[model samples]
Target: MQIYKVGGAVRDRLLGKPVTDIDWVVVGATTEEMLAKGFRPVGADFPVFLHPKSGEEYALARTERKNGRGYGGFIFHASPDVTLEEDLIRRDLTINAMAEDDQQNLTDPYHGQRDLEARLLRHVSPAFAEDPLRVLRVARFAARYAELGFTVAPETLELMRHLSESGELEALTAERSWKEIARALMEDQPQVFIEVLRECGALKVLMPEVDALFGVPQPEAHHPEIDTGVHTLSVLEQAALHKQPLTVRWACLLHDLGKGLTPEEEWPRHIAHEHKGLKLIKAVNERFKAPKDCQELALLVGKYHTHGHRALELKASTLLELLQSFDVYRRPQRFEEFIAACEMDARGRKGLEQRSYPQADYLRGAATAARSVAVQPLLEKGFKGPELGEAIKGERLKALKAYKEAASV
Candidate 1:
């Protein structure tokens, strides 16, 4: 029973990153051999076994081929002949190609250690084009390792371009694509991924709606950049600088999605971009299979685009009523995320030659105050079950409509 530690765990350990999960490659061991060795068989489609004591995964050496279309449309081959070297060759990047034996001996056939040291993301094999998903992986790794000063190899970039243009990505499942994108967003420099995807033409196929933002001009009163994509990327950069939640980051990325469609030919042009964005966000959410919360947050950001923070100067009761108008618990954290996105959106326009948005502090303060009272105090009021329901939906909203009525009564 031969066991070798493989993949991310070893790479992350070498890189000083926390290794959360461990995967092992078991050579000279069959599924039956694994079972006999006290490992429990778990994987249904693939030959993966779990160690009874350690709970680490030990997978049989396997190879794959594109049998049908997308990422999942592959036929896996697991046999004794499949070597560790073969598995490493199928990897998308050289940095991820290193494997360590059970004794912690490095077995890097592709010079992955050299590439890792050089901060380069080079493909291990020319077979990269066979799987369209590798393009997204390259972009994701680029984003994740950008802080490491890594750059994608030129030939790998060419391969990505060819795969993206070949329409092979369309065959990939939305879930897989989005999962990678979500990971990319969590990376240090998501804009690098966006830029790389755009270069390879994959961004067009996956996010045509977002791609439409390219070259679309905003009002001269606002952004100096000609396109909504530029504005959106700027907003993303601002959010990254703040290191806010993922939902907020996502909102910033999509806040100006509607701007591409807004008319800007007239002087005071680009009217009602918020409403237009709300409609478009629905389609965008569906395209990416975004969760309900993400959809609602996008919609709220779009709806409140022109609302501003003017309402916050009112009395506490008045502010409570204003916040109550929206069902908070129905989509908890939606408003907070919206506020974050809007803050980034505003800050993105701060230094433009003729910016339109107001300073962000006013909006941020109002949202922060509203959140503090609306959620915490309401919870403190001993409001539970039907009572909490009334607070979130009825009283909270009623407080806004008739502040005097609710307070005086």
Candidate 2:
């Protein structure tokens, strides 16, 4: 049996990128043979094994046929007769279809190297449209290589659009969809992921809440971009620029979704969009089954991002209430993430990216000062139970009040 290093390992190496994982395709190998050679069986759907020494994944060279609809409706054939070229041709992207032999000989039956040099993302074959998941995969690759000046081939994008309209995307499970989306959000140019999805019409199918924001108008004075959709993408970009975590980035993406629901008579003004967006955010979370931390943060940012923007002007009681709402003393990290999401929103507007967001520091300082109030001191004064809780709240309010007064000077 001949083993060839395939997929991402070879692709990244050709592009002078740091290869983090290596996947191997065993040609002319059977399941029985792999087991005899000490490879441990691990694949549930097909013939995949883990190397006894390196523990890296080694999938038998296999070919797939589209048996029905959606991603799971596929039948894979793996045998000693399956050719390396056949396995390579079945891959999604041309760049990911090339393989390398142990002797360092490269095989490029699909010209993946040529596409790589041209910085184009082209499909491997006509079967590319068979799997609906490829639409998300292609968008994710675009996001990964966007900074490298890579663009999806026009013909491939047409196939993606076809897939979006084919009603096949509806069959995709929430877990699978969320897996791709969460990965895309962590990419360097996650905005490209959203843009590509919107271009191929998948955004409306998978994330209509976000899609609805495109034509929605916002106050031009505050948002030079003036398009809610454009601003949302900008916020995602800003979140990446700040190197924020996934929760922060997800919150940034969903922060302005309520504007899409604003009445046409309201035009550029969305007076209560923050509160209005909560339902949409909940819908997205329910649809994707997003992680609890991600959903919780998104909900908070959706309900109170405007409050963050107007933090300095808020009454001391309002500010204290906001702190209590987040439970800042117990979970300071979530508050920090909320502040980062808000900062991204504030800077996302056109011509306002570099502007200072003093609200972040002001709110952070408030949290710190409020957290510094000692519960032990209140208890030391014979305050107990309900009285102890009340005394602690009073002291925290006083500290926040003092902080606000000091900041005003």
Against the true structure, candidate 1 reaches a TM-score of: 0.82
Per-residue alpha-carbon lDDT of model 1 for 32-101, expressed as tens digits?
A: 7788889998868889988899998889988888677767777888888788888778777877888897
Stretches of candidate 2 off by over 4 Å are none
Q: Between which residue pairs do clashes occur in model 2?
A: none
TM-score of each: 0.82, 0.99
- Give the Cα-based TM-score of candidate 2 against the true structure: 0.99
Worst 10 residues of 1 by lDDT: 353-362
Clashing pairs counted in every model: 4, 0
lDDT string for model 2 (176-264, tens) is 99999999999999999999999999999999999999989898988999999999999999999999999999999999889999999
Best by lDDT: 2
